[model samples]
Target: MGFTDFFSDVWDTFSHPSPDADAGGKASTNTPSSGTDEESGDEKDVNKDDAKDGEDSEQGHKPSGDDDEAEEEEEEETVDPKDELEEECRNSQGCAQPKHHFDECQERVTGQIESDGKAKEDCVEEFFHLAHCVTSCAAPKLFAQLK
Candidate 1:
């Protein structure tokens, strides 16, 4: 097996989770303990208190120094705007606006043209110039064709 497979196997061992792992994806037995209700109630109260504290913090510009930094890191991890826009254009078959549909197609093509891991400043300038020409040329033809 590869390095990833080995790492996965090791992780799977510690987790010991069954096929249908819970939402948290941790293993747990269904056996009820003596302090279950009390523990659960305490947890609920803690969650409520946490939520209230979070709300109060939101009202004020509290400098959650590392937490705010961590949130920014999470945002970077979650979505790439370029990739998302390309996917949107690629998967668009039932888009409503005619101009927008064409624009999406143009965007995807332009995106691929700059997929060489290069910066987009040059590509954006070229795309804007080309788009302006295409729009100016196509609109009159479209109007004439429709009439």
Candidate 2:
């Protein structure tokens, strides 16, 4: 990746709001907010048009009636990572496999030292090993062949 792409990704990680928050990064439902106001206005317009057409024709159309349902479905399909992160934060969890793998690696290495009665004091070396594990696991496809 280029420098710009790297920086942008880093920036987005810190800048975006988390998803698991109760508000879902949206304005509060109780507030007479501009965002909901706009949505309501659009829905009202569609409803009015549908009502007019239905009255004029023998066949009736439900305009805004189905729009809300469709939007709900779309929202369910497209989840934001920030939202997921927020949810994980709330639940005291991290992204799954990598965190577990990191803990496993530390435990396995320490266990070996204990079995051998060897004192482990190489902090710098351990840092590099863990760092490699993290970055490699982050992009498994790129590192798969090396495995």
RMSD in angstroms, all models?
A: 19.9, 20.3
13 Cα displacement, candidate 1 (Å)? 46
Per-residue lDDT tens digits for candidate 2, residues 1-147, read 999999999999999777755554555664355544444666779988988987877664656678888878788565544444434433333344444555666787688788987645434555555455444444444345347
- Runs with alpha carbons beyond 4 Å of true place in candidate 2: 1-94, 119-147
Model 1 root mean square deviation, Cα atoms: 19.9
lDDT for every model? 0.59, 0.59
Model 1: CA > 4 A from native: 1-121
lDDT of 1 at 49: 91
- Give candidate 1's total backbone clashes: 0
Candidate 1 residue pairs in clash (backbone atoms < 3 Å): none
- Residues 53-75, candidate 1, lDDT per residue (tens digit)? 99866655666798888888878
TM-scores for all candidates? 0.21, 0.20
The weakest ten consecutive residues by lDDT in model 2 span: 86-95
Best by TM-score: 1
